[model samples]
Target: MLKSEFAKTFAMLATGLSCVLMAQNTLADAPEHRIINLQAEATREVANDEMQATLYTELNEKDAATLANKINSIVNQAMNTAKSYPKVEIKTGGQNTYPVYNDKQQLVNWRGRAEVILNSQDFKQTSELIAKLQESMQLGNINFEVSAEQRNKVESELYIEASKAFQQRAKLLLAPWGASNYELVNLQLNANANRPMPIYAARDASFKADSIESQNIEAGNSEITVIANGSIQLK
Candidate 1:
């Protein structure tokens, strides 16, 4: 019985020693200094293809119902006016109502605001629609951005360029590292865009329908960027 126990203990110790030796050999074979991180970026200026604009009206009255009716009437008219431009998308939601207090802090009246938002890719149609709505509703703001389909198309092209740039850079770096070749350990790609909101040059909201005219607009451009981040093992 004692001999059997001694044999088992000796076998376990031998296995543990073998594992430690194998780990040490692996560490010796791996050159930690041979691995390097690399990054490459590509950018392009793309024309903005999408636009979003807001129009709203605010009114105050002693009666909440009357105030709501007036606000709703203005927004409804704006919505009806927008329907003429089928190419543009329209919606309404920014309805807000709050109490108004006089100097004595007494609830004297109610004030309410309603909004209509417009989204579209057809800049000309949207511009015309904005002109029509400005006759009744006040312009909140207008901004442009790259649409999803356009952004995806741009990103696909950028990735191709960014990947090639990374490879060229990696190949150029091999000589400095004293390596004739390298193997890609890992790779990652990312996309981003730099877009700034454009201000709308709006006139008085009370302008007559005939007085308001379609103004020329320039969406400008956005800078789209793609980056390639990776690690390479030199050989």
Candidate 2:
């Protein structure tokens, strides 16, 4: 009787151990939580608040020293004139001098070109300055852009809108599956701006310095976009 009882107890313990091992294996084989990926974007058009203009001058001289002096003179005069408009930002741009080669590949004369760039939030001032500079320098191009501060503010607002849109889409997608809750697995945000091409026009060197007119510029719209990408695990 003692031996029979001991055998029965051992059999019960073995059965319990086997059941525990099977439960563990089942848990291990079960698939991980499922997730759905989603993306949403928002765009806003805002008026450009900044202006940039590039003006350049070219000179051809038989002597290199004379060419450099002339270029420096013109650039200095332009810089001084720009200082009068305290609101405008001025900076010197590319200055290049290269030797002109004849058919025989011998260096003949030297040609030099210098550029000055101006930027400002005040469109009127910037345009007028460019017109004045045309007396000595040629107009390269004019560009309009949205200021950094304004762009940042607009992007911040769009980010919120895009995130909300993403969440709404996720909920709508999961509604049919009878899943009303989700866990955000990962998310990403991106911001971008669409800048228009620079405006080009014929050099207005014909206009007299005294009669130079201030240009009336229209600040076009810049389209700012923000996108949100994320994966959510439905609960």
Candidate 3:
């Protein structure tokens, strides 16, 4: 029995030593905690591909129902006119009706306003349509933007460029520290797009539709940017 107990004790000691060696090996294989953080950006200016416009109609009437009906009629007519052009998308915007008050706090008349919005990639068609619609409605504003597909394409290319730039910068920075090799610890990419300012030009009410010329529109450049940020560990 004494010999058997001594053998069991020896086995326990061996097992404990093996576990300690394994723990030490694991500690040695762990990655270093040191890292370098960096950021790089790429930008490109591309012409805008999309256009948006809003048309408004306002009227005042003694009867609220009449004023609402008149506004609805104008919006419906605008929608019908826009249907001829398959490329231009038309939608109704805000429709508001409020009562005008006199100095004596008496309700004078009901004033109502309605909006018709237009969006398209064909600038020529859009301008022509707007000119025709101006006969009954007033121009609110015009805006230009890069389409989603175009912006995405530009951003994808910029992302690659920005990432490469980040890597180059990291190498340059690490060369002074004698770090010839690096491993990417983490990375993040972000994309941004700048929209052009809206143009607000009112049309002359006295101008006839036949005499009015189509608006000349220029799709200004939109700046697309991509940024890369992350940390790299020196080897």
- Candidate that scores best on TM-score: 2
Give the Cα error of residue 60 in candidate 2, in Å: 0.9
Tens-digit lDDT track of model 1 for 1-235: 9999999999999999999999999999977558889999999999999998887888889999999888888888888887789999999967899999989999999999888889999988887887788777788888899999999999999999999999998999888888999999999999999997767545564333564353556798999999999999888
lDDT of 3 by residue, 33-108 (tens): 6688989999999999999988899999999999988999999999999988889999999989999999999999
Clashing pairs in 1: none
Write model 2 residue lDDT over 121-166, tens digit each, in one string: 9887787788788889998888899999999899999999999999
Model 3 spans with C-alpha error above 4 angstroms: 1-32, 203-214
Point out the worst 10-residue segment of candidate 2 by lDDT: 206-215
Residue 28 lDDT in candidate 1: 96
* TM-score of predicted structure 2: 0.85
- Model 2 spans with C-alpha error above 4 angstroms: 1-25, 28-32, 204-214
Task: Compute the lDDT for candidate 2.
Answer: 0.89
Order by lDDT, highest first: 2, 3, 1
Where model 1 places Cα greater than 4 Å from the true spot, the runs are 1-28, 31-33, 200-214
